[model samples]
Target: MQLSGCIALVTGGGSGLGAATARHFAASGANVAVLDFNAEGANAVADEIGGLALQADVSDEAAVSAAFGKAITHFGSAPRIAVSCAGVGMAARIVGREGKLSFDVFEKTLRVNLFGTYNVMSHAAILMAELDPLADGERGVIINTASVAWQDGQLGQAAYAASKGAIASMCLPAARELAQSGIRVMAIAPGLFHTPMMEGLPEEVTAKITANIPFPARLGEAREFAMLAEQIVENPFLNGTTIRLDGAVRLPTR
Candidate 1:
């Protein structure tokens, strides 16, 4: 869809991939709205871009709904593009040392990563459904964040993998269901990007991780993810699939 002059809502816009996407969308001429659990980060980005900042937990249905409402009210229209980048990457083994159950960790991971994405997508679809269709009868597009761990979960990533795996798994069904309303659903499974989560890792550890990537031989830039999102938005034929944004890196079993 043409981004210029259209409304776009981005979750997790405070930092990382979401922040990059928000800025890119704004620069692309979309009236962007930044939503994040970190009010300060959201405000910072929004202020920088001259867009609206909304603080809310994406896992909370009511909060997500209210955030969209505010964006709609502020922009005078529902978003034609909604990108869900809010999620947790907490890692824990299902059976930890000495058989300590990590059910709590697993549950929270799913709550934030899986359920959070669902809440945002659900609300976005509803609002998009109300808007009149554009070319090809398209109303809106929804992009979700997944991770490579979903497929190659390491030793302590059961929780994180499950959550992201669910996100990737849902793409096709979501796209098919939303097709009637001319809303497309797609998921992006990123391998190892230089996101906030990777920023603090020691150089040696980071190098070891980068060694696995076939080419580029380094962590991906956040802007690269944003670029893919922009492409997905403009290309209507790309739908109902989870695209791997990894640099052809199939992770090892740690």
Candidate 2:
């Protein structure tokens, strides 16, 4: 489906890749909705992009409902593209020298990263199913954020890897079920990228991290992630799969 004049909603759009997506969608002539936990950050990006900003924790169903409703009221329609970028990062070994990892950490990560995606995508798909399909019989596209660690997790990434792995695994089933309704589900597994998640590292530390990437030998840009999201929306045939935006980098046990 063409993005021009479509409505796009991006979760965790206050900053990072999500923010980049909101901006790109606006530039593509889509009415954009920016959802994030940080109201200030969300407002900032929304102001710059001329999109609606809503502060809502993606894990909270009530909050998500309000956000979507507000966006619908503002844009006069449900979003044609829903991008899930709201997630948390965690690092913990099952058994460390200090002690066993806290189950709370694992639970929280899963609740937000996995459950939150479900909450948003489920609601968005329901609304999309009710919309009139395009010439290609496509009503909407749902884009989820995974991580390269899902499959090639490094040391101390048990909790994070498991959560992201579940997201990656969800694509095929969701697409299959939503296919009848003309809604597509897809996921993106990004490698190390220049976002707040990868910030605060020393120069050498950052250098070492990107050294694994075979080409370009640098961190992926947040805009590059957004670029793929736009491509997925425009190309209706690309569904039911997870695309890795990593620069051909595979993490080993490090």
58-85 in candidate 2: lDDT tens per residue?
Answer: 9999999888899899999999899999
Q: Tens digits of per-residue lDDT for model 1 on 159-194?
A: 999999999999999999999999999999988999
Worst 10 residues of 2 by lDDT: 93-102
Error of 1 at 115 (Å): 0.5
Give the local distance difference test score of model 1.
Answer: 0.94
| Each prediction's whole-model lDDT (CA) | 0.94, 0.93
Q: Which stretches of candidate 2 lie over 4 Å from their true place?
A: none
